[model samples]
Target: MEKKRTISVSVVNEHGVLSRISGLFAGRGYNIESLTVAPIPESDLSRVTIVTDGDAKVFEQIIKQLHKLIPVLNVVENDDFLEKEMALVKIPIEEDIASIEVLCRAYNGNVANANEKYIIVTVTDKPYRISSFLKAIKKFNPKEMIRSGTVALERY
Candidate 1:
């Protein structure tokens, strides 16, 4: 049986590294559900968070391939980690602001901006919570929304 897994990879900040890493999964007929990459502050390295689903054997192969990459410094699975995703949604300002604010508060979201016609809200939470919040706010008829891929750090 396949199981969902989150992998955190550290790599030397250099050209073509991301392509090479992504290629590894594509070449193997594997799917990356979500991928987020950003530089580690004050360091010449980048952190990549990948969410995927696979069986034990497949995950083993994935880890082995990552280990062989020239610029890959380390690979860690999310046995214990802190993870969060962010989403921005724009809804028509004509909607009831009180209800919208209540819904936002329920999901750790805030009204980030409000104009004459649209209200932009920001929500940061776990992936499932983000999805739930979107569904709950559908009554407001959101005009646009975008969500960030998951980002994580191993527990100390």
Candidate 2:
């Protein structure tokens, strides 16, 4: 059975490393649902969070392939972990501002930043929850939406 998985990879911060890593997935005909890469604070390394779907055997292949990359330092599959994704959605300012606010609250989200024309609602939750929030907000006709890649930590 295909299942969702989040993988955290630590890699050397170098040019083309991101592309090379992503290419590995693309070249192998695997789809990356979400990808987020950022440098570790005060370090010359980067952390990449990738979300993909595949069966257990396929997932193992993906991990083994990732490890073969030159820049990869470590890789961890976050199946047994605590994971969260953050998203900021910009909804147009209309007469339904109050209604939109209500929807946000219902999804464990909040209007973090607001402007005259658009309000930025933020949500931090599981990956599927984020998707649900986005789908629910579609009726509002969002001006822009941005989602962070999954960031996860293993549970003890």
> Which candidate leads the pack in TM-score?
1
Residues 1-156, candidate 2: write the lDDT tens digits: 998888989999999999998899999888898888889999999999888998998899999999999999999986586888888998887738888889888777888987789888998898889889899889999989988888877786
**lDDT of candidate 1 over 57-149, digit per residue (tens):** 999999999999999999998578788899899999899889999888888889999888999999899888999998988899999989999
- In order, the Cα lDDT scores of the candidates are 0.93, 0.88
Q: What is the lDDT of residue 120 in candidate 1?
A: 97
Poorly placed runs, candidate 2 (over 4 Å): none
